[model samples]
Target: MLNAIDAIRIFSGDFQETKTFFVEAVGFEIGFEDEGVCVFDLAGTKLILEEVDLSEPEAAGMVGRFTGVSFATDDIKSTYKELSAKGVHFEGKPETEEWGGAMAHFKDPAGNVFTLVQYPPQN
Candidate 1:
């Protein structure tokens, strides 16, 4: 049975720049690195950045899209401001959701969009 996800891969057109963005800009620590792949240590699962040739049809579609990946934060507004100051391109200011949680979307150097989310306090 599938219990947990060990890693998530983000295919990148420029691996070095994307890896640097996750490290320097997003502050993810490196777990492993090699010629074409860099693995970052996330809270639970690993985030792997794999180099790909965008010229290939299969790879061209893998990048520059909403990744469905969210990074949890305690303070959405402050996190948004902090990341924005570091040249992160956010779609807009963080917005509170109907469920009371807040989220802000930002793009990496490879144009992959990710979310910074703050959950509402639990009762």
Candidate 2:
């Protein structure tokens, strides 16, 4: 049987900088952290940041890639402003989609892309 996603792991070249971005800029509370890994509680799911050696083949090509992690917000405009003020830079202003929702894009210190989505309310 299938269940919810347990965790999403992100590889980082600079652990401290990347970790600071998620914890301080993104406002994610640290669930646990060690020498090379930091775990954050994203709502209920876990967001794991692992320090990786870019010189290694397995991790060399994975840094600075799209993470495919989208965070949901009730108010896109407010959320955008809040995060921007916290030193988070967005691609641009939020845009409305054909599905009647709003979305904004941003990248972390490691250049991994993430998104903020605001879905339309049910009638």
Which portions of model 2 miss their true places by more than 4 Å? none
How big is the positional error of residue 94 in model 1, measured in Å on the Cα after superposition? 0.3
- List the candidates' TM-scores in order: 0.96, 0.95
Q: How do the residues 1-123 of candidate 1 rate in per-residue lDDT, one tens digit apiece? A: 998988988888998899888888888899999999999988779998999999999999999999998899998988888888888899999999999999989998889999999999999
Give candidate 1's TM-score: 0.96
Q: Report the alpha-carbon TM-score of model 2 versus the true structure.
A: 0.95
lDDT of 2 at 117: 97
Tens digits of per-residue lDDT for model 2 on 1-123? 868998999889999999999888989899999999999987779999999998899897888887788999999999999999999989999999999999999999888889899999999
- Evaluated with lDDT, which candidate comes out highest? 2
Using TM-score, give the best candidate's number: 1
The models' CA-based lDDT, in order, is 0.91, 0.92
Q: How big is the positional error of residue 63 in model 2, measured in Å on the Cα after superposition? A: 1.0
Worst 10 residues of 1 by lDDT: 19-28
